[model samples]
Target: MAEIALCFAAMALRGFGGVLGHSYDILVVRRQWLSEREFAEVYGIGQLVPGGNIINVAAILGDRWAGLAGATAALAGLTLPSTLIAVALLGLASKLAGEPHVASAERAVVAAAAGIVLASGLRTLRTIREAGRPRLVAARAAIAAFACAIACVPFVGLPIAVIVATPLAFLLERRAAR
Candidate 1:
């Protein structure tokens, strides 16, 4: 449990704009906690479920390793450090809210965050698509939908993109199947 906490804590600390990519490095490459395909599957499920993907992953992983106790530890470790930092940053941002430089910085941060999200989505999609399950035709539709969602987020934002992409993905998949 301690190890799980520490590992997740460390991952959280190192993760900034692109936590999922960092997770792939740590969990799949460095820690060897999961194989490539296993990480892909876990990440896919994490994304599909509600709330933050990484938090979901930590819970799933922690539970896998040590049941409920481990899940608690992982959640604590994953959230605590980031929460503290976000609070501190919030305080500073509030103090500087009216400054011209602050607004520019905030804009820059938003742009960067959007880029990170798009890149992370594409990376995860590629990983899932490469898993070599040709029989799962439905997976192709999902991949197309996810790709469209990623593409649209930078333009239309998430909710709208998902709303528009879902039906389009199914249509494309159906056409391809014919």
Candidate 2:
């Protein structure tokens, strides 16, 4: 458990811009924790499930390797530092909210985060498409629809729409296959 927590903690502290790619290589290629295909499958499921994809992945892999206790350890390790930083910075952010430089920095960070998310989606889609899965290719429309719903979160609210969209997305894919 400590090893799981420490490994995830190191991964988390490595920063976020290229974290996904780095993590994939480390866990699958280097650490031998998962195979490429298994990673792909888990990454897909993680993205489809609620909450941050990588965070979900940590829990999933941990559970697979060490059961419930491992999952808890991985999750805590992955989230703790960032969570603490966010909490610590919340007050400082509020105080500096009106400053021009702070505002610009915040905007930059937001843009980077959005880009990372968008790129992750695109990369996942491309990976799936390139995997020669005819069924998945035929169901691209369903994926697009789900993406639209996700984008509309600012209007429809989160978690609720995501929960509703998940099964509907699968249904749409089933329909699209016909």
Candidate 3:
């Protein structure tokens, strides 16, 4: 039980820029607690469920670690700190709304966030390109993924986009093979 709490706390503290990013991957890939395939499966299951994916993943991992009690403990630990921080920030923002320095700080934070997002996207592209595949095939796959994401915006359903693209992606791979 202590071990479970420690594991959950470690993950919760280390996670930043959202859990779906490298944080979850670290738990699976670096720690060897779960295989990559297992991580992907758990992520998929989280997406299928209604609530936040990170919370769902935490719950799943917690349950795996120490059953129901572990899940409850993990969920509380994972959410409480962040929730408190959010509430504090909101209070501060409300108090500082008319201050020029506060507004400037907020804008700076937004710019930094944008920079981080751009860097993350480029890193992901580089990873895909370097994944031992032909450049042309990888490029095509990237384009297809981009198109699918765009289509998903109008459709408003990720599963529908996946359904539509899965066979198309397979066919593209087959064509590239030949």
Please tell me which predicted candidate would have the highest lDDT against the true structure: 1
Whose lDDT is higher: candidate 1's or candidate 3's?
Answer: 1
What's each prediction's clash count? 0, 0, 0
Deviation (Å) of 164 in candidate 3: 4.8
Which runs of model 2 end up more than 4 angstroms from their true locations? 91-95, 111-154, 157-169, 176-178
- What is the C-alpha lDDT profile of model 1 across 1-178, one tens digit per residue? 8999999998999986647888899899999999999999998889888799999999999999999999999999999988999999999889999999989999998998889778876686665445345655466646567657576557657666666676775675576557
lDDT of each prediction vs. the true structure?
0.82, 0.79, 0.73
**Candidate 3, position 37, lDDT:** 85
User: Higher lDDT: candidate 2 or 3?
Assistant: 2
**What ordering of candidates by TM-score runs from best to worst?**
2, 1, 3
Cand. 3 TM to true fold: 0.59
**Residues 53-165, candidate 2, lDDT per residue (tens digit)?**
89999989899989999999999988898778878989889998999999999899999889987887677666546543676675664656666677676865566556676
> What is residue 20's positional error in candidate 3, in angstroms?
9.7
As a whole number from 0 to 100, the lDDT of residue 70 in candidate 3 is 87
Tens digits of per-residue lDDT for model 3, 1-178: 6555566566666666665675455577667888888888988888667688878987898898889998988788777766787799899789989999989999999999989967865665565454345766565667667655766586565666666666776776677667
